[model samples]
Target: MSKVILITGTSTGFGKLMAITLANAGHNVIAGMRGVTAKNAEAAKELGALPNIEVAELDITSDNSVNEAISKTLTKYGKIDVLVNNAAVSGFGLLEAYSLDQIRNMFEVNFYGVLRTYNAVLPSMRANKNGLIINITSGASGHTLPFMIPYLASKFGVESITEGLQDELSQFGIENVSIQPGVYPTEMNNGSKSGIHADKPAIIDEYGDTATQQFNALGSALFSKMAEFKMDPQTIADGVLALVNMPKGERPLRYPLDAVAQGTDQEFIDARATIKAKWLAKYSN
Candidate 1:
């Protein structure tokens, strides 16, 4: 069935692809992004021309923007059957090297952005007793990485939200899923898009050549593996579409779309689920 779907960060990367893909599949798409009239004017115009897509300016970090965008969507569409929280900012730096404000800024978009969308959308979703929220998390969200600590931490927070909300909203038939995408050569990772990287030059200088070398080596290896695995951003878009079309109660809580992980991501997800089930059983008893 055709449903109304609102996706954030639709100016580029996975969100854009998902918007296009879902709209092509006959769903009404509200393509949400910042700078709709400024930096992303072309993207907004291009997507807006599509019959199924309505371009909306939405900066997820702002409660007013999120609320307004969702309000308009609900008012027009009558209901949003699915929300794809694909909007997020990525950061890379040593934990100590990042200033509190920088870290907070990253979280404002990556973590709190998800919260804002949920708060805006959940009331209508609950009233309808049917909705699905798919969050685009990271491959390292299940664990952690060195330079990308802050970024992964934010994604991890979303993972936690997806899990907790799965049960919390179960009674209302609202389903939640986090899509853990591996290294895809999107604008975010390919240097076309800017990220909230480490700002403390003095602290970075203190870490010196050794730290630089390690960060460089890690980047090289990740890029190499990404190329080797042929990680396509479209895979994530297709995954979101599949989840949307899935039977209401049959969707998995965590969907990992990392070919580079070579099933290790699935293994980690399975192991974590098993451990969580046992832990919950103990608490219940």
Candidate 2:
């Protein structure tokens, strides 16, 4: 059965691929992109030509834009069966190197942006008492990585928000799920570099240049490693399909899309358990 789905960040990456895939599946997809400029218009045209896709302007950072997108979706589709909050920006560099404004901007797009979209869609979903909200988070939400502090922090916020919503909205018949995808080959990796501070503060002067060089080297290596394990966008899209189609009671609260990420998470869990056991044994004795 085809359903009405609204997805953000359809201009590129997983969002765009999912929008196209779902539309081709005969689902009514309202593909939302930032600004809806000529480039987005062209991308929308390509996706819309598929089957049941509609393009709309949505800047998740702006409340007005979010409200308008929701209003349009409701006006056109009458009810939003699924809302995929996939719009996000990646922030890179040492935490101290970037300005507070840069860090705040990262949260605005990644954390608050998801909130704005959620708030806009919640009313209708609540009224109908049936809906699914899938938040696209990352492995960094659970594990830390060097130099991507802001981006990881933003995803952490997402993890918290989605978990809270899952508990709070269960009674309202709204299923909230957080989908964490491991690094994939996408514009996001390139997009992350844009957030690097050109006027970044100098590191501790004695080791500044060395630190910068090490950071650059690490960043390159991370990207190279990401490429090695990068899953196909369509595979993640298929995961989205599974989430959307899952029976209400059977839907997973959190879906980790990367096998390696699951393994890494388990390793961390085991390490934490060992540390806790050692601490308890020492203190209790």
Best-matching candidate per lDDT: 1
Evaluate all candidate structures by whole-model CA lDDT and list the values in order. Answer: 0.95, 0.82
lDDT of 1 at 178: 93
lDDT of 1 by residue, 1-285 (tens): 999999999999999999999999999999999999999999999999988999999999899999999999998989999999999888788888999999999999999999999999999999999999999999899889999999999999999999999999999999999999999999999988999988989999999999999999999999999999988899999999999999999999999999999999999999999999999999999
Q: What's the TM for model 2? A: 0.87
lDDT of 2 by residue, 111-142 (tens): 99998988898989999999999999986687
**Candidate 1, superposed: residue stretches over 4 Å from native:** none
> What number of clashing residue pairs does each candidate have, in the order they appear?
0, 0
Point out the worst 10-residue segment of candidate 2 by lDDT. Answer: 192-201
Locate the minimum summed-lDDT window of 10 residues in model 1. 87-96
TM-score for all predictions? Answer: 0.99, 0.87
